[model samples]
Target: MPSLRVLNHAFRAWRRNRAWAKHEPETPFLADLLSGAPTCLHVGASDGRHSYVMTQVAPKAVIYAFEPSAFAFEVLKLGIAWHRMGKQVTAIHAAVADKPGELMLVTPKKSSGRMGRAYAYVAETKPNGPARPDLEDTGMETQMTPVVTLDAFCADHAIDRVDFIRMDIEGAEQRALEGAALILDRDHPHVLLEIHPPMLQARFGGSGEAVVDLFLKRGYRMFALDGVRLEERTTLVADLPWKDYFFIHPSRAARLPDGVFKARMAA
Candidate 1:
């Protein structure tokens, strides 16, 4: 049995997630794409609220959720068992990067404003930009986490088909994308990423355009949701107005709802 504090935290997290999903424009689209049995990669999975939501929306979806923070990973595992989603959702205790190496995983001791364990991220060097301000007051701790490339992880796990990938690994999106080059080129899975321009520039000396270029060069069209409608994005500026965007390969475009993504209104 779990402790009272753990149970209370779980309840609060569940409630918060429910409220968050209600306003999220991508939630319905996720349901649409994941209605059937699909292989999903949930990078920066935190305490597994999103993975738990995936299980609810797509009962047969096999989710490989990765979280580097030890504290968050424990919470994620507890949630997996609490929800009885252990069979469908596999939690991995590692960070994804461009190469297989080790990085320092920084996590706050408690919730820092709206940010909590979910904001935990791995860095090869000291964090900067938007990540810098948080470190000033938040009691922080670091753990050396083993990093793995998506391409290697999939090849080793024999995941030939990845239907969808939800990545929100702070500023390390580009590196993770680089690591998954093989998967991106071969499977062309639907990628939904949260691109933080300041974080990107601070951590990797890269910008949002660089992240968009990764998909554009691969013949992938990126789209952003305007409330519930999907609008095509031709170019990504250095300052991104939106954080979450969808990167879909031309071949996979047909899988999405024609009415939503087909209109192709420029963003």
Candidate 2:
């Protein structure tokens, strides 16, 4: 039998595709920015749904997907095998962070030993201290997971070029970006990131603007989906309405079709 989580994922994908068919604007699909034989990273890939989408859109695209949670990694591997996509997607079990080290992954308590919860996050750590183990009250459990930096991973795998990256690592986006600075500088891949303001502040002790600045400082322009059109953003407020954003380097902006963005900020 399929896991309940896997069934839920399938339902969500069906609904999303139904919406797109109705011409309801959702987050712009990866097809908008990807093309032939691109090298991509699906960081924080859970269950490999996005990776499957990548294969559907760009058949020749090679993807390296990283998932930290043991349960999620199992599901991801199952999906890969189910889809027979082993040749195109390489699923690895590890967290992507600012440095290559171990971190505690905190996830909500599950109903059974075999079931898995969603939206697990990196446990908060004190300065020069170990991960906090006081999450019991929050109905969460922690496990130590191997961590790797994008720069080191790419170099180790001999991956010289990256065309696109989609990251949704809970509130650890800033840390992942810090880890990928080398690749960001060299490849300028189109990045799709989800900014969790509450998680950023409460868990990571950071802000959305700080994450936005990470891209702006690197000459990457920010754009957000408004459910109707994409809007270029120069800054983000505390109560910013959107969560997902596209941080496109200047070099890749031309490939995106015209009129898709409002261009609120000059490029």
Q: What is the lDDT of residue 10 in candidate 2?
A: 49
Q: What lDDT score belongs to each candidate, Candidate 1 first?
A: 0.77, 0.75
Off by over 4 Å in 1: 1-7, 16-23, 108-115, 127-139, 237-242, 257-259, 262-267
Q: Candidate 2: where is the Cα deviation over 4 Å?
A: 1-28, 110-116, 124-138, 237-242, 255-267
Give all TM-scores, in the order shown.
Answer: 0.85, 0.81
lDDT of candidate 2 over 1-267, digit per residue (tens): 667876666455445543444321333457677778989999998867778778878899999999998777877877777677899999989999888889988775543543234557776442222222222223456788899999999999999999989898878888898999999999899888888776677678777889999899989888777555677788763475237888888776665534343233224
Output candidate 2 Cα RMSD. 4.9
Deviation in Å, model 2, residue 191 alpha carbon: 0.5
Residue range 1-267, candidate 1, lDDT tens digits: 556656766666667675664435675666655657889999988778778778877899999999887666777788888778989999999999999989998665454443455556778765443444324435556689989999999999999989889998878899998999999999898888988777677666777888899899999888787666676786663355337888877787666644455445222
Q: Cα miss at 3, model 1 (Å)?
A: 6.8
- Which candidate comes out best when scored by TM-score? 1
Q: Model 1 shows how many backbone clashes?
A: 0
lDDT of 2: 0.75
Looking at candidate 1, the ten consecutive residues that score lowest on lDDT are 128-137
